[model samples]
Target: MLSVYVDLALGLTVSFLLLSLLVSGLNEAVVRLLSIRSKFLWAYLRDTMDGSDAQGRSWLPANPGEVFAALPFTRDPRPQHSDQPSPAQPGELPEREDKAEDAMVKLLYQRVQEIDHPKSGRTSIANIPPGRFAVALMELAASEPDGVEGFLGKLRSMGSPLYGHLKGVWETAQRDLDRFRQGVETWFDGEMQRLSMLYKRYVKWVVAVLGLLVTLVFTMDGLEYAKTLLRDNALRASVTAVAGAGPGAYEELKARCGGDDPVRCVTETLSQPALVTMVDHALVSVSFPAEGDPVVRWNGGAWWDRITTPSHWPGFLLTYVALLFGAPFWWDVLRRVTGLRSRR
Candidate 1:
């Protein structure tokens, strides 16, 4: 009797673990398809250069999106823009409204559109090394006819907040280019940390939505599965055996597929026989409606009930909540439980 409960516990854990992996895989594919990382990175750069907050509220005296557009790093170096002004042409001071800064801004905006939905080739890089960014910025400042000091004067005349920021960095570096680059790198790193937090928050919502969808599609009713496991001795023993057989494969999969490389992890792990078998068992445990067809027709039942009977709601909710705990959480639990069983 004690062993029966143990098997029931193990079976549910295994089921949830498999479902979590499926959700994780789908989440990765969705993220990649949407180019979410690239969008976040671009947003960060835009906010910084435009002197605006995340909500586009400006706190700075002057916008530097124009200055940023002048930098070569933001524009693609390909042949399509061969006839355009050289990115290094910042040496030529602003002419008129028709030819100088306005044209560059238009070109940069076009580049942004291309980045968001490219007709061909990969998306714009989601990450830029701090060192590379620092180099491009410093070189832009140095490219002026009178050099860095002259560039600072132009910014000061315009009451640009970026001038004050870079002036402090220049002073801290004591007029040394290498030290200035290093200081900029440190500043860029701090900004990247904030971007990382924002990206994580975005990912959390993706996980929540994806988990709910996967749970509903699989009809994974936790309470029903628990009742079945408790009542059927043969089914309980079989699930226990499968659960016991899984640890070796689980460890191998964990090592090969880590949190860092989610795309490859999803591609490889979902193809394994161990995961496939677990998913089969999970489907077998699903509870389908015995009365009217839940899909095609609805009788006098309440609108909500037509979606899922009241009795199954708790189980569906439970399964979805468990999935929100994520694959790594269940993986850890599974490892510890198997270790205890082995010792016994």
Candidate 2:
């Protein structure tokens, strides 16, 4: 009884680990092809810099002339005008509006563009160090005619909440340039941390969708695999033997996955023509729909029923839920389970 349970557990773990690798590889490829990380970062920075004031005034320049004047670091010297009704002069100041914010937006974009490497035909800054952000702000401040004080003057002109936060930081830094830059860096770090969380939250939905698709494409029904392992002693023993073959075999398997970088590994592995053929025979033909759960067949019921029997949805759901734990998670689980099996 103990041996049966151990073999079942080992077989299930091995199967899950293989399926996870496939899902993770495909996901990495998708992320790269779409340039999701860079796009998300660009969006966060744009929204943060361009958020409106409480009085409904935009942080972007209301005037095209002012926008052009603020573009000191931009590649193109020519003005890029939008369709706003009115254009304000650079020197014009409103009692309620902040002209300096226009400059800040321009400067922020300049920084983003400086680091914006193109991926999949889209340009965006994938990552920016907090130190670099702090440095950029300080440079903007130093460019003012009155230096830091003039910069503070611009901050004071703004009615936005960002100004209030900067006011606190400036006071805390005692008007010292180095200390102020450090404070800015700290502020940027906090914002990046929040952005990181948001990025992960959004990406999880994409991951879940991909996981479900992979589960269906391969028909990786966890419940079905478990049942098979329970019934087929030879299959269970074969899977368990492969897993317990020691660290050398495991390392060799990972090496075939394209070195250490997850993205490259996944892309390289899946791009191979041999992988499709290998998938048919690998893991006892689990991925071959014809050999397992025939996705299309003629049955006496409805077409949908023939394509997908009602009994398979539960297994598909189980596989998808397990995949959400991700490849790294399953890799660790495989290692631990194999180690335990070896010890016993």
Candidate 3:
């Protein structure tokens, strides 16, 4: 019994440790994968900016005057054409072109601002050309700064080389991001498979454990009956007489003792095989108390002296009933820990 208890304890401990390790490993893998994905996304965005066409050009400034001053229009102004109809006035025409250009400029300026001081508002700037937006962005990239600083300072420091480096980093990060995404997909797939396997394994273990427990319970019950026999002199005498009999004589004696109370009559008449076999079968049917039942006690005396009444059947039934009821809860916990029910 002591050896059986040790074996059961060891098995449970090992199972618990294995379950813990599997769950922890799955969690760590997922967290690390997410972290890598976040970094990859950041790198991809930076690279996209580097590859843009506005690297070394000025688009718009927080102050409109600064943008107008930065433009090359002042260096080489177009001659006046008196014959052509004057460009429509802002109030007369809707200024759609200017507004569009302003929006683009603002967008570019905001990008630069984000690269510099991340907290800057993403307001759109105006007065940018449509066809040259990409090129202007590449040129403006040079204005961004090298190291971390405020928004404008960062914009002023970015150069062509820096843009190229950022582009390279972006490409690398994109590849890594793709690979990481694939890895996560693969990992989740594998996790589902592993969780299924573990659940099946645990179910199998539960069935085996429960079966063993039932068998042990029944066997202990039989042992209890044997102990009872030791106290019942008539039953013990009947068993002893049966142990000393031959099969033919026992059959004749059983036939002669047959009656309404055949088992009792056999014990009174044959006091042998017929009586002992009946007693053994009766003993086998008796139920054992559950583990935590109050009836189970250590008397600190002879081992066989410990005896219990049949009143604790309810406790035994309740214990197994509770275990059966807890199956759903265990299943839910396993699903949550393994992310089995989560959508990708």
Candidate 4:
């Protein structure tokens, strides 16, 4: 009975781990594909005009995208070199610009053509040096004919709004432009880092939510499935026998999942029909409401069925929490559980 219990529980656990791994990898890929963090920062920095102020006064410049475009902190596109290249035809014009593969890089390059490589004299800036963007903004602020106070006024006129805290900083560094610039850069760096962290947290949330939906769709609730094993003697005997052989199969499953590349790991592991059969066979053993269980209904059914079913909330809640443990964690858990069988 204990071995039977372990067999099904471990299978369900591995299934959730596999699904969670899928979710995590997709989250990482989608966040990069969408360039979520960079897009958020770009939108924040646009500083486009808002028509009415609290004082009901029309802010001077209605837009500031052009104002930002004139700044010198962005990177230019770099040319790619092919492994093998043929000489151009005698009259063939040399290629000019290669489109950037990264949207964020392309966006930055488009803005900084004039100042990308100030020393390079109108050539596109190959890359924005680290710490350059904030530094350039600070330099621009300090170089205004008036001090920080006056430069901020110009920004407000050009549609950039100021925070009270930033407005307050000018007084402390009133005597030293360099001090003011450093403070501004430090503040900007901190804010950008915060935004980056927030974006990462958002990606994690996406993975968790997606994992939840997947578990539900697949009916992978752990608690209910375990109960099925307990109630069905024939199914339990079959799974326990399968579980006896699971250690060898699990070793292979571990190797496939342990590969360096996540997509490759999932693809390779999923291709193993025997391993997949273990999970699918375990799922087949689950008892159902031949009567009217909402867990059986993918669509609208009864809210009461979900709430009243002893296994519903507990099973789903268990699976949901299991997903949060992540694939590596559960893979290790599976290893430990299998280790127990080996000891016997």
Q: lDDT of each structure?
A: 0.58, 0.58, 0.34, 0.48
Candidates 1 and 4 compared: the better one by TM-score is 1
Q: TM-scores, in order shown? A: 0.60, 0.63, 0.18, 0.47
Task: Name the TM-score of candidate 4.
Answer: 0.47
Candidate topping TM-score: 2
Model 1, residue 173: C-alpha shift (Å): 2.8
Per lDDT, what order, best first? 2, 1, 4, 3
lDDT of 2 by residue, 230-318 (tens): 64554334335547897665465455443575345544434443324323422224332325564433323432342277787887788
Name the regions of candidate 1 deviating beyond 4 angstroms: 52-123, 154-164, 234-306, 340-344
Minimum summed lDDT over a 10-residue window in model 2 is located at 71-80
lDDT of the structure predicted as candidate 2: 0.58
Q: Give the alpha carbon lDDT tens digit for every residue of 1-344 in model 3.
A: 35434433333233233333434454346434333222222222233332223243322122333322332232111111122222222111112222221222233343333222111121121122222333333343333343112222333233222334334433544635334334434433454455445434433443444533432232223333333333344434444566797775455545545523446664444444322322232213322334544333332332122213354344334333433433344455556544568457
The pairs that clash in candidate 2 are 63-88
Q: How many clashes does the backbone of model 3 have?
A: 38
Give lDDT tens digits, candidate 4, residues 1-344. Answer: 57666766676766766877877787667644444433344333432212233445332222333212222134211312222222221111112232112322222334343343322233223233336654554544445557466556654543334434356556676747667666666666676676556555555666677777656555555675666544343333433454677666545544544535534554433344333332342322333333665242222243334445665767778878888878777777877877743344
Which parts of model 2 are misplaced by more than 4 Å? 52-105, 109-115, 120-122, 156-161, 234-307, 340-344
Clashing residue pairs, backbone N/CA/C < 3 A, model 1: none
